[model samples]
Target: MDIEAEKARKFRISDFDLIRLLGTGARSSIWEGRDTSTGKSFAIKRTFKQPEDDNRYLDQAINEYEIASRLQHPTIRKVFSLKRVRRVFSIREIHTVMELCLGKTLEEAPPNSLLEKCVVLIEVAKAVHEMNSKGYVHADMKPDNIVVSEKGRVKIIDLGLSCPLGTVKQRIQGTPSYMAPEQLVCWPLDARTDVYNFGATMYWALTGELPPTVVPHQDNSISAHQKSAIPPHIVKPGIPLHLSYLVTDCIKIEPSGRLGGMDAVATRILVIIRELERDQEPTFRIRQRHGTGHGGSFLVSEYRSVAVSERLGPERHVIR
Candidate 1:
């Protein structure tokens, strides 16, 4: 037997308990698993093919491992290990183990107040900024790809289709709803592509709607030129106008028109966060000390109706 075949034969299935199927992607099927040795939970990914099938997804699975190995960020999911050699009915397969973020995705989770959403959004923007800094674009970013931990930790997961910032793939690869105009045209991609996706993601989160984009797979009539996305401000008048503008800037049809890069987006959003924090610092602090909740439990003084306002944040949940 070859080295891989020998290794596969030696590895035992008892080492890990595959709990259940998590989800299926273009390259692999993800399973919720627990290591028998450490009793630790993980999301296990493997080629989604029967034993007799050829090695089509195996290479993509390996590529995902290579590309993901470089990432190390607080908000990005960690790939703990890779099992490149596995056996199922004498057929060699591949497996990748990733940290299992504890909480549900943004959509599945209970409704988060706008402030909570803003807090989540900034962290995701920071993660995207880091990826861009390292010369990679998280070519695939949607709400489902983002999971919040029980303790409120945000994690960006799934790197199956991520590519180098400027790479021109053989074909388009991205969720149709989130793809930027450049992706539709197969143009050289960069951080701005992620900006557009992030903007569209924000639009959906705020209005419970998917923003318009150039999706060639669906139809040619709604190309970026033929249609314009309805700005979030109009869709939901309650969202702060400034916040809506921030998202709109990211989804500009022209890359040059985007808000510079993800780093800049992060910085701009940080400013907004600081402003919100400052705005609430005065009377709200006294209320917390005097025993009052965030609702209408005002202190019955000059600032009686001083309730904490609902705020907005960011996140991406995959839809397909």
Candidate 2:
């Protein structure tokens, strides 16, 4: 949209046929571009003017290039090339060409679409696990940074904020709501920081509400030392008990108490999937639906039965 900034730029959209604007951010704009020679579609992230306030922007760009080029996973967006273009005004711009992702962010995804959300989360967890195993961490993990493809494939994007383990204490970066407490305090981070963020992301997926910015502590509370944290189930009753426990564990005030790493999180999710499958009966299947397009239609029936006591039999069945 800033025509003056782009005028006479070596990486003009005309060089490669422009499709449409994808999105714009503080320092860059993303566009869908087709390579003139190969006719291949790629997402081009172009930064016109570097932020004068933050010297880290250039470092982030270089880190992104380095990180993306080394990663090869189905759930991580692939980088095709990195180009440095200079304009007539003697200003240089950096363009990163990456795989074009087609779906909306998790923030924009509709509520009650539980299945799709779980699938996406699982894919992202796998990707994060891969990164953690390689001794890296996606310091900025949030809904908007994740891309869900048309076919429901999840890809983690925007590695500009990512860094190797124990290298993020220089600045407090990442979305505040989804940021771990250590990140907020500008402490040296590791895989545990990402685990905390992943928990926050899951909390959002399970409940439409976002978690509080800071946790509150109660003197007599069981987790009094943990601070302002509340269980996810307390906010959204529909969340399964196991899942609520898993999420809370990931967000524990002490990083050591959280899941060991992304691999542990992925394993737990896989275990949940298996348990759900094993519990399925020929008469009915219980699964959560995710995203929009259902039009409030109930894909399956809702049935609830009460038990008065451990010795009592299942009580009256209520169907909704």
lDDT of predicted model 2: 0.69
**lDDT of candidates 1 onward, in order:** 0.68, 0.69
RMSD of each: 9.6, 9.4
lDDT (Cα, 0-100) at 298 in candidate 1 = 19
The digit string of per-residue lDDT tens for model 1 on 28-49 reads 5666788998998888776645
lDDT by residue (9-110, candidate 2, tens digit) is 434654587776666676677778999998989898886565354535556776798898888887788987877666665445677888888666677653
| Candidate that scores best on TM-score | 2
TM-score versus the correct structure, for each prediction = 0.75, 0.78
Q: Which residue pairs collide in model 2, if any?
A: 113-289, 113-290, 113-291, 114-289, 114-290, 215-228, 216-228
Q: Which candidate leads the pack in lDDT?
A: 2
Model 1 alpha-carbon drift over 4 Å, by segment: 1-14, 25-27, 50-56, 86-92, 215-225, 278-320
Local error of candidate 1 at residue 83 (angstroms)? 2.2
Indicate the residue-level lDDT of 259 in model 1: 90
Model 2: worst 10 consecutive residues (lDDT sum): 311-320
